[model samples]
Target: MPRRAGAPEVNAGSMADIAFLLLIFFLVTTTIETDAGLDRMLPPIEPPEEDVIIKQKNIFQVLINKNGQLLADDNIIGLKELRVKAMDFLDNNGDGTCTYCKGKKDAESSDNPTKAIISLKNDRETKYGTYITVQNEIVGAYNDLRNREAQRLYGQDFTDMEATYLNPETPSGVRDELKEKVKRIQDLFPQKFSEAETSTSN
Candidate 1:
């Protein structure tokens, strides 16, 4: 310990060692929390061809503003209604293509689940919670439809099929069967989520 002209200084001899020990304690004892959630593995991205044209009816627009307000299909709607709305749009069966689809054949809505593209646009200031909720709702719509189809085709849940496919210890024969089922289910309800860039003005 030492005292300067107008300041008293405590002993700093073992301060470094104490700090080091504290650091080691935190490193050893502290449990770091890792973010865990659903296994969301996005498919590979394929750049669109220049001449490709998307019909206006096939693109379902979902807009989120800075205030977390949702505008789906050009109509201001609540989060509770988003999933059902999306499901209807996805399974519209307008062209009578999807034999399993039970949705109303709304010609103004999407053509089919395969060609239905969910266009999501959010403002820069949109709340993270709003964004996540919207995402979950949209994804839930697809999952619900796929589950229905899986149940009809394989008498199993699509989520379980996906989990089994992802598991490494699954038997090869069963995995192969599940692979075909999964692929067929996915082809029936291919999730085409197109997230537009955030609005710069927001």
Candidate 2:
């Protein structure tokens, strides 16, 4: 018998079943993940009861241009000096309540830790990386001050104490105590950050 030259037929009877099995397997084994975003607490939305006037000397201005260049108090500054400059401004304590502060006490600087404020202004076109880095440096300044105060008063690091409070299994009483300790440290180096809108064209 001579075989006719024609396209060979394939047995596709199980093709649908195989594809369905594959879909079911993938659906069962694959795990979908949700996005994990930057973990930060936002400020309260309520407006202040009264407007308070702050001295220009007590306000430390930090400007980040669209080019990522930094200006500290109108003076062009490098990233390396930002932390130190912020620390200096915060710890000046010219009002003389910060016994543990080691600042130079310049009259033109902050009058006290309570009075010190950092005003951050950034152009709309600023790079996200630059903005985050600058924010980290400013927060690092506050953390350094808190850590020093925690060590001086409680003989423990601020992070360790924070962990004790943040743990879910911690007893409510113990957490309350830790909260008070954390509050004390915060009182010593209050973080007063104000964000300002600037012209994006710059």
Candidate 3:
């Protein structure tokens, strides 16, 4: 009788460890993306006030459809042109009141920055990206004007002021000074914008 040789068995003693290491490696390598929502400051609650009537000429109406089509002041405009149109509408001193304004002085345009209001409306099915783009264009229009004014007055850009004086690292005294400057700029280019309810139509 001859003794038969047996096959070598697989050593699985470290298999559990290997599997755990693989699981950890996958967990470390996997990246999850997060949605960056609109970076806007929420308005504080206030007591009900009387409805102040705003003139139609002062309101710069902007409409967006689900297809991302922009209707600026009842005229179809591309996204790239929205900023210029908004800037013109805001900076236009139709009444020759704003000395800072350098607009075309159209009688039908805004009388002053304070009176210029942007009325933004979108369709219910409008894409979030499109809405954000439109909002950015409007905001950029304001920023461009503010930055130019800041440069003219303070010899610095508005964004530079924010980065230097508004950051957490700024000193308390310096922050107060910056606040005054920012308030001045706000007075010059007040953001009197309003967002209306989504329209039912496309």
Candidate with best TM-score: 2
**CA lDDT scores, all candidates in order:** 0.91, 0.90, 0.91
Q: Candidate 1, clashing residue pairs?
A: none
Candidate 1, RMSD to the unseen true structure: 4.9
Better candidate number, 2 or 3, judged by lDDT: 3
Model 3 Cα shift for residue 192 (angstroms): 2.1
Ranking the candidates on TM-score from highest down gives: 2, 3, 1
Predicted candidate 1 versus true structure: per-residue lDDT over 164-188, tens digit per residue = 9989999998899889999999999
Candidate 3, residues 67-185, lDDT tens digits: the string is 99999889999999999999999999999999998999899989899999999999999999899889999989999999999999999888788777768989998999899898898
RMSD of every prediction: 4.9, 2.6, 2.6
| lDDT computed for candidate 3 | 0.91
lDDT of 1: 0.91
Q: Which stretches of candidate 3 lie over 4 Å from their true place?
A: 1-6, 25-36, 43-47
Residue 196, model 1, lDDT: 84
TM accuracy, model 3: 0.84
